[model samples]
Target: MKILVYGAGAVGGYIGAHLIENGLDVTFLARGGHLKNIVDKGLNIVLSNQEKIVHPSYATDSLATLKNVKFDVVIVAVKAWQVRESATEILPYTSSSTLMISVQNGIDSPYELNDVFEARQIIPSVFRGICLVSEPGVVSVPSQCSWTLGEFQKNPTRAINSLLKPLIGSKLQLKVSIDEDIIKDLWKKLALIAPMSGVGALTRSVLGVCLEIKELRNMIEKAVEEIIVVAKSQNIILPDETLENSMGFYRALPYSATSSMQRDIEQKKPSELEYQTGAIVKLGKSNNVQVPVNSFIYYSLLPQELAARSDLR
Candidate 1:
């Protein structure tokens, strides 16, 4: 199967590297210095266990080159804000049967993809890993992670299995599972990530530090509760033990663990705040649920994000 991975950042680059390493038909849609680095030195991935440099079937920045090409599986691994832009770029190359994978970390990404592609054509998945682009064409994975993917409205189990066949046995420290209810899974992940990222950025502290502080830990729990309420209002009933389980999960994480949003905020780069905590606040408001904690987090971070964008432009 021909696969196209858009945005060769940390998550996309790492997944694409493993797919190429296992001899799959993988192409990367990259641009800027990353594209140049891939063209000159190939793609380099530093795994938690080892390192690999792979040259995939193709890598390109220009859409004109791929005008006639067709991709069976298109993994949209761009950030939440870039989903619409990425879809506009890749839709021209997608046939009706093309399985569009939403690998972003937000609730609206699936709907964004559905605007251009059919909802049934979208496979919503959650990426559970800490990865980043240390440099152009270089992806650093500091821990093992997994992807929980499933059909949103269409059952593409067979196609998903076929796509996952290549990485059956590799040292990538990755796992893939099919979730029967992918939307619920997405909400569950959001419960964990939104609070963690919000509090992480707001406090400018790592996971462990956030948990160690009494007030911050309490805020984190309240944020999770708010998210659960928001999810329930949308008819997605999270588990009763979700908050506790998520707290346990975060508590077990290393002391140095910080969310990517925190890193982006610290570096003065554009962040996924709009999709992360901001989504929760919007959903809560629509549901008439008061998410004061998340609102505080969202509003507090808004100016910094706006300033970052202004500086970039």
Candidate 2:
């Protein structure tokens, strides 16, 4: 099956490198220095133990170059905010049978893609792992990577399995599973990430430091509760134990671990703040759910986020 990894950043780059290593037909759509490095030096994946470099079947920044190629699977690995634009850009290369996978941080990506493609053609996925682009053309995987993908409206399980079958048990340390209800999985992950990232960015600290302080830890717990309430407003009932379970998951993470959004905010780069934390605030307002903790987190971080995107007025 021909696959196109649309945004070859940390997540996309890591997944594409593994697919290429296994001799699959994959093309990467990337831009700027990352694109140049991949074209010249190939894609490099750094694991905990060893490093592997594999050249993709094709990699290009120009969509016109592949105008005639119809991709079977298009993995939309871009940031949450970039999903809609990315979907429009890749539309010319997608046929009715194309499966567009949404593997972004927030819950809005699949819906965003639905504006461009049929809901039946979209697979909502959640990526769980510690991976990042250490440098141009290079991706680092410090922990195991797993994906939970689910169908929306139509059952594309057979097609989805066929597309991901190759990477299932490879030495890439990757895991793949299909969930019956992926929206709940997405909210569960958001409950953990949105609060952690929002609090981490505001404090400019790691997970350990954030949890060490009593006030910050309390805020994080309340933030998770806020998200749960918002999800319930949409009729997605998260487990009653979500708050405690999320805290336990956070505690198990490496002390130095930081969310990608937190790191981006620290570096003054554009982040998923608007899509992750801010999305909860918007949902709460629309649904009449009180999310003071998330509201403080979002509004407090707004100026910096606007500044990072060069819209700080």
Best by lDDT: 2
RMSD of 2: 1.9
lDDT per residue (tens digit) for residues 62-159 in model 1: 76787588888888988899899889989888899898988888788999999999877898988886888888888888877887788878554456
Q: Going through the candidates in order, what is the number of backbone clashes in each?
A: 0, 0
**What local lDDT does model 2 show for residue 306?**
95
Off by over 4 Å in 1: 156-171, 311-313
What TM-score would each prediction reach against the true structure?
0.93, 0.94
**How big is the positional error of residue 231 in model 1, measured in Å on the Cα after superposition?**
0.4
Cα lDDT tens digits, model 2, 42-133, are 98889888888888889998778975889888999988888898888999999998989999998999899999999988989888878988
Q: What is the lDDT of candidate 2?
A: 0.88
TM-score of candidate 1 on Cα atoms, chains taken together = 0.93
Report each candidate's C-alpha RMSD, comma-separated, in the order given.
2.3, 1.9
